[model samples]
Target: MRVLLRAVKQIYRQPLCNAASRKRSIASSSEGSGLLQPRHEKLIFCSTAELFQELGGNVEVRTEFISEEEESAFMKELEQGLRKKRYEFDHWDDAIHGYRETERDRWGAMCTGVLERLRTVAFPKGSTLLGPVHVLDLDKAGYIKPHIDSVKFCGSTIAGLSLLSDSIMRLVKEDDAAQWLDLLLPRRSLYILRDQARYEFTHEILRDEDSVFDGERVPRQRRISVICRNLPS
Candidate 1:
């Protein structure tokens, strides 16, 4: 058996608390839906003050960062066609959509709303600048192969908010596959990758595997990921 690292052991050592579960209600597909609205589902996070993990060297996890209402509302907007039509990128296996600040028409305003939420409430301490928000839609079989974000285009820190389902993120060295780590990312959680993680390691998710977390076998579910890069310095 692979020896579990300190970060992995520390995370499992903490008592697992039930996260508030509130499933988002999918609105009927409308060709022309306005801004995304909040549906207000109850959400919960671990009872601990904060959950942190050092897996893959330089990544930190904040399990259940956004509240139930916040997550539900965000999804409502996304599924209601507020975002640009979903498109496929040859480089990515999953259908991806995003809103950028530069495009000042529709997506720009929508993306700015996301940024405002992160500033006023999400961080709680103070506001942090984030780049364009990209939404990753994964089907039951959807998974991302190992890869790294380009520091040339984005800041060193990358944060992603998980919605809808639980999944595993496997981190591996680009040149050495033997060195790897597994992270259990629960729904509504926010994980940030930076420093070595942003610059050195490549991250991947297995195609719908039973992700093991704290000795429990958690099955993979269809998930949505909203990724935002750090504001450029």
Candidate 2:
């Protein structure tokens, strides 16, 4: 009986040991991926204070969204298990958004660092885990019209981790003509659009095969964005 118990313990330990080993491997591999390196000649690091000071509104940016190795592994897991799985839509009277429950154990474990980082940022009080992280998939022609987020129950911050593809997020002022500011959000990017950017402007992702900027056409790719925000009260 003692031998059998020892054997069971060994089996359990094997998985834990393997998980640790895999994490080490992932960390090492991420050091080599270009994801950690800045993409452009000028790197943009936006903090809440800087956003308010410069834009006269709240917005922040973190260049490294997730390690490429981690993203590749997660994508593999998603493609194997979560791909083509349709999730329910959270619907209001007129607006609609897709929702999916992330693999909580994995997501929580992986995103702990991200959440910790956010805690240091300026966020509203009474914030709680909004829901399971959701993968918001937008097709070639799919678009979300301008609207403010629902912050009645939770804090006003909405964090998105871009995945799978590249896209643009446009913020339009609420003035007579509704002027716009266009931001190009790349894959594996973290975007925090809140405060005035959230309430005073309408944000949208246009439906198009390509986006044109300065006479250059940027091709669109299928996009999956992971969103984390507080639940509505």
Candidate 3:
């Protein structure tokens, strides 16, 4: 009960509206109904086509996608759930602690506007958004193995949001021995993978203290990622 009250308090913190408190997975009746929601200040991102060109086709990343206040609310939701339910599956090889499939409507209900915005930016219009969306909770020591996403079950494009901390995602060609690109996935960044990048290259999180980006080693932080996908057409 106290946790929920705390969440309610955070939910009303101003300057950033529509910031739903993610506390112990308890949402207000209005949030549950997706009605009469507060308006959120829209975040504007300047697009540069050449950057995507340099990165590759079907890959887009928007940094600073959410503000600090919103981040706090979202974190409160995840952290409380993590504490109480502790519903996490461990993966030793990948250096991952918790991996689980979650329902989009249940988990996504807290911030409907943000999820809608993600769909508009990440998916083609009129495409059926498929679930079970995944939530990845990682501690400081956590990392993931390099592997290509399966197209058999989950087809085409994959979109995800990085929360809590910065991430360094590495990629390598499946059939090649040479090292590939290392990307700095900043906290609050939204990353999308499709086409060549999805089918061709494999990505992972390494078990290193810091990773290089443009010759500089950048440290990683504990993070929670919300991943959503578009079904194969």
Best by TM-score: 3
What is residue 10's positional error in candidate 1, in angstroms? 24
Q: Write the per-residue lDDT of candidate 2 for residues 59-177, one digit (tens) a residue.
A: 55454557776567556655655555664454342232343334332543455665455544535665665655555665555555555555454356677767766566655555422
Question: For candidate 1, what is the TM-score?
Answer: 0.59
- What do the candidate models score in CA lDDT, each in turn? 0.50, 0.48, 0.54
Candidate 3 Cα deviation (angstroms), residue 124: 1.5
For model 2, the stretches where C-alpha displacement exceeds 4 angstroms are: 1-54, 86-108, 118-126, 231-233
- Candidate 3 wrong stretches, greater than 4 Å: 1-55, 85-104, 107-110, 208-210
lDDT of 3 by residue, 32-151 (tens): 222211211111111222322444445565666666666676676567656554534454333344443233355444456667777887887888767655767666666665666556
**What ranking of all candidate models by lDDT puts the best one first?**
3, 1, 2
Candidate 2, which ten residues in sequence have the lowest lDDT sum?
Answer: 1-10
Q: Best lDDT goes to which candidate? A: 3
